[model samples]
Target: MEFQGARNFSIESPGNDVFSSKYDDDGHVKRTGTWVTASAHIVTAVIGSGVLSLAWAVAQLGWIVGPTILTVFSAITLVTSFMLSDCYRYPDPVHGSRNPRYMEMVKNVLGGIQCQLCGWAQYIILFGTSIGYTITASISMVAIKRSNCFHKHGHEAKCHAANYPFMIIFAVVEILISQIPDFHELSGLSILAAIMSFGYATIGVGLSIAKIAEGGNHATSLTGVIVGEDVTSQQKLWNTFQAIGNIAFAYGFSMVIVEIQASYLSYPILYYSTQDTLKSSPPENQAMKKATATGISITTLFYMLCGLLGYEAFGNKAPGNFLTGFGFYEPYWLVDIGNVFIVIHLVGAYQVFSQPIFTLVEGWCAKRWPESNFMAKEYHVRIPLVGTYRVNAFRVIWRTLYVILTSVVAILLPFFNSIVGLLGAVSFWPLTVYFPTEMYLVRAKVPKFSVIWIGVKLLSGFCLIVTLVAAAGSIEGIITDLKTYDPFN
Candidate 1:
């Protein structure tokens, strides 16, 4: 369904005053990020190591269907992002109030039960995502080390891809980085992450071009593009929908949009910025639409290039990960460099995605234990212009423990592609399809069961069915994979 940017309408409820947005003194928009920064944030948050799997995902669909799936999902995500953007404004202009958190927005529209469920799902999905990043980072380090060893010893190199040491190292680094107070604080990192994403995409594309030039056309056409005789009907069906799920996962960033927008607006109108800032000098709607469009378009191009090239290069034999599949070429420095870029990019991305969870959990804790020391304000050291943040001992302890836990889980499971698929299945419908559409309907007061409303419901139901099937397949795949690898190996 097409969502218009101009149709943003406010909703008023008597007890909605509890929702608030934060602002700076003098009420100017305190955290107004430039379009460049917002674009960077979107790129960093959306394009994780997930793109490394796109070639394999599309390989399941062949050249014809693969690109179609990528383009279709990209448009869907862009439309949902617009639906979400409209909700960032205040429900009541006079109160100048806004819901800065996704959970808050869900609570405002769908009521408390759904809001609680959304909060749970959001944190779980984000945490699962962080685990996927940790696995990717660890595996990338392993690939780099293997490449370096092979360069020195040729066929005699005995390189192992162990998860524990690198997982520990990655976890420690993430623990240090995840301590950043807010999204705006991590803008510089986001920019670097964007650059790193581009670096990896370039490497993937360049290598694919080189491989094709070398006549590396050793691929079986199991994807039903050229001929359907190579595989059974069941195999084709499974791979086709599996490919759809992977594409959906690749575009699953809707849950984090509200948090990213928070960086642009500082806080919503309720917290600090005035209604004048919202009505008069606020960031232009078109500017944000452009930013969102530019970021997603660039990402879609990169994903398609990597998917098409990798599929054409390796065909049905394409490895689950594009970079890992490159291991057949010995002593390739480009492979090492690309893997390093992946590690760096995932590190930055882990923060971009995890910070929202941190914000929501901390806010929940502060409210739940108002009288406890866990909620008490304390002093933190200054970081230049950031000034001394009012630190809480609980924050340092809890967020650290949380990172450690996710790291441990990654080390234990280390099921990279499967975990990503699972998380994507869980998030795609609620965060991407259902919640945004439902909330928009609520905000716009479109009558229930009308043509538009029934159409939305039917669409949402279809999405949920597809995702459920996807989740089941992903779970089964993980079970099969688990039999092949022991924990921490």
Candidate 2:
């Protein structure tokens, strides 16, 4: 019930007496809590905005090949998730704490240079998450304005593209909600968005299918787009890299998920203490494996609905968020109704942006000020007001600096495109392609491999390939786009 002599509250699995999992053989769930409960869904959250490009990615690659890569990549990552759990876990008493704990162990396994590299990768990933969430918030706002959701609610909506005020408003609102730092508020926002999204998509997608039955183009389902007018090897190469990069990123996040296994080791007690754990449970831990993947089931269905119905009803003009593409699929009247939820989700997206930094930074602060309890952590402290504020203030300043630095690098990136920018410019290499594999190797105490480990080695090699290609392609695309924009040549 206690970890490292710290009696704290976190999500714990149901007692081994009632329900248990093969992955969670121990009586208590490991390292489990609210974080673990939310971990699985975090992928969708991480991949949330990027899903907009799914069709484009598929269009670039062969139709069947697109999902094949995803499936294979997902399977490999699924195995790697379990593999990561094994590598990082101590079957006996001590558990590798979550990502940070795993990082520490990996340092010991790989030695100084590699450990530092791994640390940097994690650092970027942590911040990369912030960037992706921020971009999603920005993009969602634009999508909302384009939707009838704004008009129906009768909100003053206008062009948000290049509008600095809208961006600032969102950023400020996000900062406030983030200040709350309670699971209740954040999860409430996430759940509302999730439900509206999943719910609407299901209904719309069904209607779409019915429309198709009433003689729509069946070829949309069984269709392919041959983009890249010239069809050069470089374009093919770029497409391949993007696909691989997507796979590796998916796998990378999955590796992060196993730590959720250890995290939940303490969940039951934490939730029980609060009374009616089910009442407090969130999607990933509570709804995923425990409820037979219910949360993701809901999510996947929603996504399909959005993709299919949006595609079918709105055609190519499908708006990517909050039924913004209502005009694409149906009348603007739907957009009118959707306006309410759109605001709700802009708030949600803002929460997503604020949360990662708040939680991650607060964790750092807690360690620095270990002398203080929760009350002190929340409000004031005896440790010199300026000093306490300075420590906290420095974190905010540093994180902002890092965010700015990341944006600078992203802009500098040759491929201004999100996927390429992410993979090449800043985020991908450190988190997905590098950390998990190296951490696993480090934990294994060898720079070598077993037969099964050979599989990991090959997979890591593929990841490296994807990483290089993605980065290169992104850089190339950025240059091409820039040159085209001005045409100095």
Residue 397, model 1: Cα distance from true site in angstroms = 3.8
Tens digits of per-residue lDDT for model 1, 263-341: 4333221122111223323443344566678788877887888888888777777777788767557437889889989
TM-score, each model?
A: 0.80, 0.62
Compared with the true structure, what per-residue lDDT tens digits does model 2 show for residues 1-489? Answer: 322423463335454334333123222333234433443343333333434444344444444665565455444444444434444333211243322244444555556787677556655555564444444444445554555445554345443343233445555565445444344444556667555544443444555565555665433333333334424666667655554453344334432343222222222111121111111234222322332233334444444443444445433222323244343334454444444444455466444434444555667877887776541334433455423321244444444554455444433331314342344324444544455566665565544657756876788776666667766665565556676542111
Candidate 1, after superposition: displacement of residue 213 in Å?
Answer: 1.4
Name the lDDT of candidate 1. 0.71
Q: After superposition on all CA atoms, what RMSD does each candidate show versus the true structure?
A: 7.3, 8.9
Lowest summed lDDT across 10 adjacent residues in model 1 is found at: 268-277
Candidates' C-alpha lDDT: 0.71, 0.44
Q: List the residue pairs that clash in candidate 1.
A: 21-271, 22-271, 97-270
Q: Which regions of candidate 2 deviate over 4 angstroms? A: 1-47, 91-115, 149-165, 178-223, 227-240, 243-252, 259-327, 333-450, 481-489
